[model samples]
Target: MKIKHLTRALILGALLSITGAMSSCEKQTQTQAQAQDGQYVKKGEGALSNVMLATIQSAAYTPTLPTKATIIESPSNVLSPRTENDNQNQINAAITNLSNSGGGTVLLGSGIFRIKSPIILKSNVRLKGGGQDVSIIKRDESWTNVEGRGMLESGGYIEDLTISDLSIDGNRPESYRMSNQFPLFGIEITIDNGGTTRNNRVYITNVKIVNTGMGCHIKHTNNVILKGNYIVGNGTLASSTHSLPTFFHNVYLRSIDKAWVYGTNYFKDSPGGNGLNITHLTNLTVEDNIMTGNNFRGIRLGGSSSIILVRGNTVSSNTDFGIGLAYDETGQPQNFSIIDNTVNNNDNNGIYIPNNTKNGEVQGNSLSGNSPLNIKKGTNLTNVSCQAN
Candidate 1:
């Protein structure tokens, strides 16, 4: 009789535990539903009266973090000739496998990997190749890039990612020639947070990208580095117009914060737009790069950029201005320093600054042989110094 009483007690305890678990799950579901009802808060730096003052006071932002410690399997045969008809599936499978195992590296071997779809990138992963020209990623003959996606496109909110030592021939002329489709891009990453939150810590080094709309088009990111890359001959629409559309660019950055772009060689850039275009950005340092033979401006900066330092670069022989800073009604560009650059032989002005810009300095630059006027500025400049050009 005592044993029978103990069994009944055990059964009663089990039922109570299950009922409590159900209640806990119901509360969790309700919390999730509430959060999904437009209540998710994006992270950001809190309110600041003076933006530049806040930038000066805050600690430096760094993005060289590797999230995982384990080394997952590296599929060297992801897109080799052996994986011919199953290139997309094999590549996705490898990436998914690595992601499921808590994020790792995708080691692409030396081969021409052809794909018909965009390769999704995950956070905490390094996509490495066998040095620059060994691993080439090209689009297949039957490929049609839906929604104007890039050859290597990153999804939402990725961080601690590095892509190095590869060549991406995005929709090369032969492939697009057959399909008559334009607007192909190489290495496009976008994160939409409206300046509330920025995707962090992306480094693309020693990569070569060519034959696309733009070599690198990044938006709303933080602490990015584009170093030692060769980007060329973008805006591949066979046109002879001097004024290419502004949307086409070789290296386009928008709404970026804290970027370091250096040692990039952009040749014959953007049959449609500028070689390097920066807009709505802050704390950008562009140095030691060569931008030549572009169809449009060599480097164009506008859209309320702030704290930009353009130094020690060569910009020459473009269809339009060498380095241009235009007016933006939303907010004028502040603390723009054009120093120690070689700006020569462009079709339009060299270092053209429009009205309403503030606290600018153009010093120690070598400007010669530019059309219209070299170092032209509007009369409404405030506290700006243009010396020794």
Candidate 2:
């Protein structure tokens, strides 16, 4: 009986020893993780406020403009779908007249309008549609010379313009299926500062853009807001024309500053191109966006961008990285913060920052299902803290 009791006590002692060892190991591991937190510096100091202030200072300030006055009605006297000639001239003429008379709304009532020529938007002009579902701006096949250019083009220091509640179909399947050489862009805003005008305060909202060579090309512009818009690159059409898919982008921006893009859906059917491609930007905020099913990175930042805050975004189901931060041809990205984002199911890393990147913070992100690595970093990556869930 004494032998049996001694053996039971020995077993209990061994179990206690094992438990104590596990507890000590756990405490040691936690201390190491806590110590690592102090290694990197946090970025995005006053980033949100700075972006907002810059937008307020530079934007066209059209809050007091009347909602329903001085209108240029569409079906545009001479340019309806049933008309024999394309309505490009009529549309431009109306826009020119409105701009000359200060500024007003060009109301697209209903139905699809075939635009054979580029619609150049002028200062303080608002191009509004009845609704996204009703008003369609389709590319005109009859205009062969203008095939690869943007259907609606803004340039020459244009400002105080708003494009809202419209659907632009690039007709990629019909246009590119037979010919891979066609250059198609949905909306392109180019800033030429040589003129006295500065392309500032451009507001785009509730716009549905699909099946284009690229969705919206915003280059060399400032104080731009792209909100509540649907920018899609349907893989079916892109795959139909094999070569074009390689160059497609849902929304591409270059040399833009004080831009706010939020509440937007970038729906890519296949791994075709990036959902948002930004380069050489400043004071940019991308929040509350849904980017999924993209072939490339969902959001890419490069070319020496600063004060960029990417927060509360769902970047998932992409064929490549969910968020890609790297160096461009000119320079490296800096002063960025990626926080509170849900990144998942990407083919590569959920968030990829090459060691060459500088001055960024990656914190409070819920990441999973990224193959190989959830967060892939490069050398010389500084001031960045990645707290994994």
TM-score between candidate 2 and the true structure: 0.75
lDDT assessment of candidate 2: 0.68
| Residue 317's lDDT in candidate 1 | 92
Model 1 C-alpha lDDT per residue in residues 105-153, reported as the tens digit of each score: 7777898888888887767667777877898888786886443678888
lDDT of 1 at 27: 17
Q: Score candidate 1 by lDDT.
A: 0.69
Clashing pairs in 2: 148-183, 271-295, 355-378, 355-379
Off by over 4 Å in 1: 1-86, 174-181, 193-195, 236-246
Across 193-268, the per-residue lDDT of candidate 2 in tens digits comes to: 6523446778888988887767788787778888898888732223334434345578888787688888755555
Each model's lDDT: 0.69, 0.68
Give the TM-scores of the predictions, in the order they appear.
0.75, 0.75
